[model samples]
Target: MFATKYRVAGITALAIAASVSLAGCTINMPGSTSDSNGMMDGGMMGNNQNSSGFSGSDIMFAQMMIPHHQQAVDMSTLAETHTTNPELLALAKQIKDAQAPEIEQMTGWINNANASMDMGHDMGMGGMLSDSDMAALAAANGPAFDKLYLEGMIGHHEGALDMAQMVIDSNNAEAKTLGENIVKSQTAEIAQMKKMLAGM
Candidate 1:
């Protein structure tokens, strides 16, 4: 009886030891540390503040600006073949060069979000040109085309200003910087356009 009791106690001890060893090995398994660290990093990035500390407003700004910039690019393309003014041609090229990359940057911003929703339609106050207005611009040529382009772009830039102001107070650094750029650069362009129109 004594021998049997000792044998049973030994078996129980071995079982407990085996469980402890397994637990320790599980935690120290190859790649476990790296996997945990990776998960933590991903979690941090998924937060409202990404690597650049972007906010919901920033994402929305990017998404909305994409289509807006596209329209501007399209308008500029129209001017390329329609206008003979050297200044207008230069401005059209400038608009295309500046806005095309911006669309790509904004796209990347939206894609970084885990499940970003479409916020482009929620706030449509930006002075988007009407279909008739676009049609008018398309149908115009020479001095007429130049006038329509200037007027349409002025209104379009004004809409962008409104949108930029809406997000000027955003906590996201990139968004704030982009907003400031829009305000300053577009403001200057608006002034330039006004002067050109006056001259015409």
Candidate 2:
């Protein structure tokens, strides 16, 4: 019994020593950074806050959504041309007027930026409409157009909100502030659209 107890104690001590050795080995591995550098290299610390991932989330959301808003405006304009209903035409006009100026506002910001950049919508985060979605909008009219428009725009706004949050999370002050503004404005607009959809 004493031999058995001594053997178990020895084994336990060996195991602990081995674990400690392994931990030190891991920390001292060649070119393996410790602290923040280790966190950075491991992609375990967090995404960069200053680089692409660190850059303002607002700019990212806006650039991607600029083209998206332009597409919506274009769809609204087309709907106005094909529809005879004053209610629908007026709604389409409102969409065009509101989005056209926003598109200009965003593009002007980009043009004024210190660098030129593009967010390939292929990245899956741009929140822009797919080609099929635009086609669906193109074929819709009257109440149908309004329904599609509301549904699609709601989704579009949600996408912008999603991208905007990324900027906020990344910790860019300007981006974060703009992202908050977008969230507030868009959430309100989405509620308004729900009411409009219900009326339709």
TM-score top scorer? 1
N/CA/C clash count, model 2: 2
Clashes of each: 0, 2
lDDT of 1: 0.64
Q: Write the per-residue lDDT of candidate 2 for residues 1-200, one digit (tens) a residue.
A: 11112112222332343233222212122343557333323212222332332232334445555776777687677777556667657666776777687777656544543223464332323334567767877887667767777676666666555545544554555556655766787677767777787887
Model 2 lowest lDDT segment of ten: 1-10
The superposed Cα distance between candidate 1 and the true structure at residue 14, in angstroms, equals: 69
Deviation from truth (RMSD, Å), model 2 = 17.8
Misplaced by over 4 Å in model 1 are 1-52, 115-117, 120-122
Tell me the deviation in Å of residue 70 in model 2.
1.6
lDDT of 1 by residue, 1-200 (tens): 11111112222332333233222212111222335433223222211454435544455556567787888899999998888999988888988898898788777766664324344242433556767777888999999999888888877777677667535776766677778988898899889888998999
Off by over 4 Å in 2: 1-58, 84-91, 124-127, 167-177
Q: Give the CA lDDT, 0 to 100, for residue 21 in model 1.
A: 26
